[model samples]
Target: MVSLGYPEERFEDVLEERRCNSDLLFSARRFAPPTYKHRCPRSPAALRRAVLDSPRLQQAIREMAGEDGDTEALRQEAQSILREMGHNQGMTVVRTFAFMLSRIFKALFRHVRVNEEGVQRVQKVVQECPIVLLPSHRSYIDFLLMSFLCYSYDLPLPVIAAGMDFQGMRLVGEMLQASGAFYMRRSFSNNPFYWAVFSEYVQAIVRNGDAPLEFFLEGTRSRSNKSLSPKLGLLSIVMEPLLRAQVFDALLVPVSISYERILEENLYARELVGVPKPKESTSGLLKAHRILQNDYGSVFVYFHPPMSLKSFISGRLDITPFSMTPRHMALRLSDTLRVLVHHLAHSVVLRQQHGMVVTPWSLLTTLLLQAPSDHLFPTSCNSEGGVHLPDLLHDVRCLRTVITKIGAMQDWPDAQSHEAVVLSTLAMNSSLVTLTKEGRVLLNVDKVDRPKCRDDILNRACTVLTCAAYRNHILHLFVRPAFVAMAQRHAGSVEDGPTFSHFCFLVQLFSEEFIFEPGSERKDYEEGLSLLQRCSSLLYPLDSQHHPSTITTNFSVFLGQIFQPFCCSYQMVCNYLLTLEHGSMQKESQLLASLQEFALQQLLEGRSTELEILAINVYKNAVASLSRLGALRRERRKDGVWFLTTSQLHHVADAVASLKPPSQLPAKL
Candidate 1:
């Protein structure tokens, strides 16, 4: 076991408790949180009144209407917005839903593992101050699971920030509202009145400590099963109270929820390949009951110890300006404060990634993608390109050892043998892969019926993308080292300066693709370098002044191939840009569709074998990177036009192409 430098505890199956004593869920004495005791908590109605009467909203109304303008009209508009955004949490409703979810969860998952120590940590810290729950968003089940966990522990039920999409779901919407979900428009910057009311309402909750506030820092569900860059808007709103000294201190808890099998696995994969996501509705919600028929192995929820908002900002920021400014006045975040927020957000994501529990399936998928040929692992594949069962078990064992040694937390059970654990996991995910009578594991593309296309490529892509999602679970552990490996190959030498420069370039180019703490490229480089050195892949310079480092092992080649799909996808995007007319404006939606079609064509023609290139998220990130590099210029037109390509596009394309490995590399290099 790797030490996390904090107290570790055995995971308890929370659902098992629910199963044994269903009555306890209803009869248990819910602990009154310290926030409620320290101050008289505001009722939902009182909170709304406070937000309306707050100095900030009043000033905003007056300013927007002017001295002689109709202030009442703006106030009415603000009231309307508040009505749309506020939550009406009722204990009766919470209990009702909790009971229902208990049954659903019991039917769906074999186990729900929660870190007892983490829960106890929250129980203790919550008594000292208000808390903000930040959970990683992978599926709709995330918020529900969080609330259920909180209810199980008798902790305060957080008032969750939900998107307006949930607000339109008929009776289910009202039930969600009663269960403590407050909806907000996805974007409100264009509406001054709405922004004022929303900000004040959020600040009021923090200032009053009414309930622990909760929100997804990623802003939305990650269809790719990876961390999205943190959204700073809601985070900034919550921190404003501390900055202005409206609240003494608050705790930010980063919760990491890892699923053995995501409920939306197929949906996410299809959506990534240009299939539209089904709308959230009561009918759709009822239709989802079919999921309970299948068994999702387990879920692990790790609540990191609470971080102090005061301590986070103490030495880093000078909050005097915020203190001096009137509470009612709008204060722009200084460049320094913005950077601090960015770092804090990134830090939370890093913590979540660290706390994630890697499943055996994750390691298995990683090996399957990385070890496609026998040269990497002899006898790993059969004549038909399928993985041999025994060889897969051997590879999985080796990978598990390497990954665990590198500090990844694996959820392999102690009660079962390694072979049993591997076989069980494979059976659980049979939809993605299947074992044939011949003792070979093959991708089960035929399981999902699709329209007959020109070729079987798209059908094959569905399975590859799903497998890729599982592989992405443990990617954080390898990304930095993989970058170092790729950089060394591209630089064609192990010189510290050139390799480090290339590493920095790759990090910047793929900034949108991975989460790197802001302004920490140099630190990341050192980390990647250290990991490679640990693997004995790179040797330190003997003469520090004149000599350069050297690659001493083939491990570097193995590491470099981890990002081959990404490099291939990014290069394809650049190549498509090269085909576009110079200075021609292209709508982003049209461009993405065209790119998807182009990728499909390339696949059919065998020009590109990387199935990951079909994902729209990859293309989206590629567009973002190119735009940041000034290769694609956004045309500011009244019609809200698309990007304009510049000559710099060619240079960007060449750079990406240079990083992509040859069509095939020797498995042993």
Candidate 2:
């Protein structure tokens, strides 16, 4: 049930990969019956029309129209909006495109491997009840891939909740519509008419159970490639059916799509660093056709076990959307739904439930990004010219052991041996890894082109960003170890590991760069401390005190490299935060705006390209962390001012100085 690799032509390579990694493949057990083709009982167009004609929707339209004092006019307006927002379920077209797009994807990627077992679980859920497939949004291609994956598995194609961006592309829009993609604007909080029409359309689809539903919980692709705070807008609208009892039960399946390389990594990096995003258009898509010619390595689709709404709210509390007489009432109960939406989105980020695929490329990229650019070869391989394969192998084993101990790899039972996993990953990513004439290994990220123009400069920038994006896939897993390493360096003695209070203080400092699991601060602190203890024990077994001297210097160096970029990013942000006028409240957006400018200025001043120091996502995270620590406080939700505490500023400055490696930053703090 491991990913069945892409492209029939490369089927042989898939077979060879399986043969080598057979020890780690998912069981080939068919837990369910072979799935037959499923067709929607009602077309999305028909559902929209029914909702438009529903008495409840008509009443809501009339109520809104009365504000302008024109009920009939508003009714007509509502119908027009419904027509614009509706999705067309062209069954024949969907089937045709499914066949064609499969070929297209196979052509685009070196391999496309679907977790057979995960897909089967989803298929079973499809038969039992309605499903809302909430996958992480990493690329525009996610929308198509979700539907395509369902279609390939003989399950009914999902009605994808896509953004209005795609709706503007004529042929592309029409094709997407024909294949069951419904478009919604990024915002409609002011447009009551559009909101009613859109809400009804989603509810009708869910109620009818004609097709499984799909949407990105994040609302848009994350430029940083990490999970963003979830946007509750669409998820709140879609869950109205369950709230109103129109559907007895709906399963929320959080999907994790891991790519060896992102298709839009360079463009995303550009946007992250303050380049205005180019709007999605037919011409833009056509211009991007060059992507198909390039190899994008492999894509993995892992479906986490689904969550039931009834179970999610069990024994906690209840806002009975049940008491509401109609589906429209559920939409009006925004606060209740928002709480539920947050839980659903947060669950998607929780590692225990999220089905993340850890590939060799991710592992290797982590090592490469962590290692100093100048120190590309292992210390033992100083006379050699390539990568130190043995060191990498050991690190891979260590990472696998760490993740396995924490139960992150439980879903993929076949990924048994860490060595096999690393070997298989290297074999699959043959293009990225190579041995030099001196028999040393090196990642080929240094193929710099002399930029004669802005386009060339941007292109090289994108290349590095794409590589960083891959490394980021495993970045979260390294957070605690990195913190331990950095904190130890600051302690200035290996024998004296930071006190629990000091370690927790360090966690607070790096909060912007890593997301710890949600719990009481004490629980998070304990978990971090425990992980450090485990890692220290594994490396320095003879001495359990986590003494720096007892730990192998090689292991210590590896941990330092892992911790460096985050520290660099933190130092840059803290420097900016310290400059803010004490007691002067700053709006979140305004604070981030200033920080973004500072990041760009530093980039121009020659910052390391090894990490995304200017990343807006990390900047926002730092602000959130500061707020949690009482260094900043929100004055009001919309007041747009975060009160900065001068007293807490000193602590932040101190933490930043301690974590900053002397080699990277000046000694003066």
Candidate 3:
């Protein structure tokens, strides 16, 4: 809801409005309420054409390619190809390769083991009835991993509905088709009909055993590094068909995927912090291809127990489209995703927290590299080493405990070496900058992670800002503005460009001083102030009177450390900010403010210590739940920001008021 130039995509309010549209609700005379029973979709090919002509398809194409991008013609052609190439046999082959590749990467990374729990449930259900594999969506690799795991274990291959934007070359499209993937326009949630077509197609797949379907119930990659709202557009569409044929028995398998040290996570994190958005250019895709080629991460999938809707159709259990429709499916999906997130944060991601109680290596590496300005790690953690930094090893003890809790999971390898590998991978950086010939004691950090001191605490705080706790605290009273009313309508790209990258580069540039080699006379505090000064350009001040103890020095000292000639950077950001005098930069300042508000609240709330907060996935899971609820209603703020659906207005108002316990939620029944 900050004035930053980004789309105010309020999902909840939209869902509410769409649901309560009195006109549509009363349209029975025109199209008639759907009949209770479904038949084989009439000439399904005709339905495909209707889908091609849907408004959503036209709108999504216009979003990226402009009004004259041959939207209609392309849709028609796409559908023609889909119809002609409908059922594919190679789903098995692609799935096999995908699983083999994933397993290969896991071994190469020496990651925690992948133990498929609830294996019998998945197999038994698949044997009894058709299934829809609704997994929590994570990365691009999610598609292949799910398919491979299914077929490799003797289950039939699953058809995935992937974004058309990712289809790439014709061959890739063909490959996906053969792998049982159907293309969907990336931004088609708004247009009703295409969703209808896509829904029906999935319905067809499930109604018959043409292909069991796979879905990332959460719509997209979790921005907060957890699950996202399960976009219900498809779910709504599939309902009528299921209701009609009373094939109410189809099972929904909840799949969860966890990763250890995802390569693209840093890129996603960068985008979150305010980089210029990148376009889908050839170079970008090529970059994605290169990352995929590395295959440097682990993939773990757990199949939660399946839920069948058959009992409801037989008049045994009550079903409200919202509450019980996919209750079991959603819960298990949410829980599994949450576990995956925590596993990565505590056991894999390389960073430090207050009271982290880690091994000497983790503490040493963090302390040496953590100096805000100094690129190097201090030579040793002693007064004799110069600069009396805090006792890092003691500080990190709590962090180690979180890791231990993470490792306690059933899927974690029951071996210590694997644990070490998982931790090392989290700390790995492609580039090495060493100040010492022996590369010991202190000096330059792993080149890759130096992109920014990036304030590890701040990053976690920002990611958690989506939490109900933060939303209730910071965003509750500050309502969003309407899209059309926004000061600068539409969003600006923050995924690319020198604007933000320069900031990261400066963080990295200053990190060099952390290791300052043995003889360098730079004090740790001095190095910090310098780095702070260089980094401050990327930040702005707020409520000067309420400055937290975390910042214990005067502004001038900070300035000196940043601008000194030895500082690494094209130039310090603080200098640039003061020079530009862009007063409106406060909008660019929200994440930090958001983080400050969140961190302070968490401290006051006494829920979890900082390291425990960093390691937990609860924040992300709550955000996903609320986001899903938010998307189903309509509401807007005075500043043109979209808010929770008016119906869910109370939910936000309540959550904003306090971080209520799960028991605080009202009874659904």
Candidate 4:
């Protein structure tokens, strides 16, 4: 049996249960597709010819020639661009690579578990309609995993939309192209010819239904490891053909992939702190291959139910043009596409969140992050001492119960399973965590006695940040409970506590710090209340403002601890913004540099944890949030300079700083 990267006894029941009862269509030969030689129609060469000979494209080209000065040279330029952007969907090559990659990846990881039912559902959808596989973006392996899953299921492979970043990798790029990945320029809005060819090429694929299309709606990997607000660039282009009735419709499948350990966790965290990321290149790929000898835990892939565009637009008002015979009908949809794009983008995020898989690493990270900094490691093996194993187990049970009640524990495990998972995870990550001879878990932080090199020091520093990245994967699931605990801790007693409205205000205020989904304030409030009721009898919302509730000794340190670092970091960003010149514009790069310098100083002085508090990406995102809140503005010319929009910088700073959790939170203003 292949390693599933999980303890067999713990996972056996769940996997077998799922396999037996799965109602997925065509389940007989679903997970294992019969392997055979086949050729995909509509090859890259055929797609290019169709695009060039397209009447709509020719008209668009002609219009460009007259209005934008396009000539025979420009026409040839368009053809060349098409050739450059197109991909060859060679089934034999895809199959060969898929088989080889499965072996290579299995050797690299402990387990790779795909939701067999999910794959079956995707296959069923593809048989009925065109599919758009919209997966979350966090690592480069995202598209590779999607393609491999489809190939393994014997379903048609997707024509993946890849960024131009990979196009520079000569042999690798060509191999990717041959394996059904198409290249797209980062920016091609100014080049009408490029746009024409690219649009037509995409339309040809969707219109033909030769294969399903796949791309990350987030556009690029998120350094913070959160689902970024979706980028609508490719989505808009892909939807154009369906909107114009050139194709029947497409099914958008939102896929969420969870890694027991991320390959780029430390690198992503480093990039967040303003460390320059090495460019993706063939040489870099080769260099990274050495790490395959090490074990990465498990990989989980979950596919949400497919959403049809036709059903989505069923009750909505038609943004389509009234003129059915208008020239460039397909391109006309692009003008008013933002509304549709925004809807789909938001849907993708919610679906991705819903489909997220929770593994032992995620659960363990959550527990460790929430524990008191000192108690994170057991001091001794004695039962009456620090971080008792039973206490930890109880806490995990409570967490699993509450989160499951709140609909966030899709993959929650039973006690035996949970224990197995914890033990297995600690064993796998012994360098970062360990089980004492008495079975007490302790974080491994004490340095080795031997002399260390510079690289070793850097690796040790990255350990915390990589752990933070793992913690972030399940962070959103704990938001409501965190908010409730923060509120309870902030209030001295129920009599002097905040009102429900005030708590809601704080949730909105600190939205960006935790990447709260838009318009979820009320839902968060209700869930927080549910958690508070379960965790403590001392805290309860008052029926009237006149009769305030009471607070007790019972409270969750987990809520406050998990959010403190993020809250403190956000306050630091706001404080730095106040130091900027009033009403004066400053380049964002300059602002980030100043923030990084200040953070470095704080780190040197032992006043800050650099990973959580000093990351430049966090500050950059904070500024963007402030801009959304009308606290700042950006220049039009794309110089990345932000203008201080309000004169009340001090007031804004104070407001944000007040939302910090109680342990680190200051007295209420």
The Cα local distance difference test for each model comes to 0.80, 0.62, 0.38, 0.65
**Residue lDDT tens for model 2, 365-385:** 765555444344223324443
Model 1 agreement with the true structure over 238-308: per-residue lDDT tens digits: 99988888788989999999999999999998899988988889999898889999989899999888999
Q: TM-score for all predictions? A: 0.93, 0.77, 0.47, 0.82
Colliding pairs, model 1: none
Worst 10 residues of 3 by lDDT: 475-484
Q: Provide the lDDT at 174 for model 1.
A: 93
Q: Could you tally the backbone clashes for each prediction?
A: 0, 10, 56, 3
**Cand. 2 TM to true fold:** 0.77
Report the error of model 2 at residue 9, Å.
25
* Candidate achieving higher lDDT, 1 or 2: 1
Q: For model 4, how does the per-residue alpha-carbon lDDT over 1-669 read when each residue is reduced to its tens digit?
A: 122222221222122223334223222333443211222455578778878888877787677778657467767978888778889867556656765666566656665667666677776667667778898887888898788677555777788989988889968898899999999998787776677788788777777776778888877887666677677767888777666676667788898887777788767867776679988899999998766877786676777778988788666646355325454534544444577677777777767866666666766666665543444433334232224455456556555554555455334334456667566777777767766666566556554332134343334345556667777787766667777666655554443236455566556555554544455666767777776666554333322312011111234554566667777777887776777677877777877788777766555455654346756667776777677666777775555455555666667677677765554321110
Q: Which should have the higher TM-score, number 2 or number 3?
A: 2
Candidate 4: residue 160 Cα off by (Å)? 0.4
Give the per-residue Cα lDDT of candidate 2 at 219: 75
RMSD of each: 5.3, 7.5, 20.3, 7.3
Which has the higher TM-score value, candidate number 1 or candidate number 2? Answer: 1
Candidate 3 stretches with Cα past 4 Å from truth are: 1-113, 276-297, 311-669
Clash-forming residue pairs, model 4: 4-111, 5-111, 494-549
Q: In model 2, which range of ten residues has the least summed lDDT?
A: 4-13
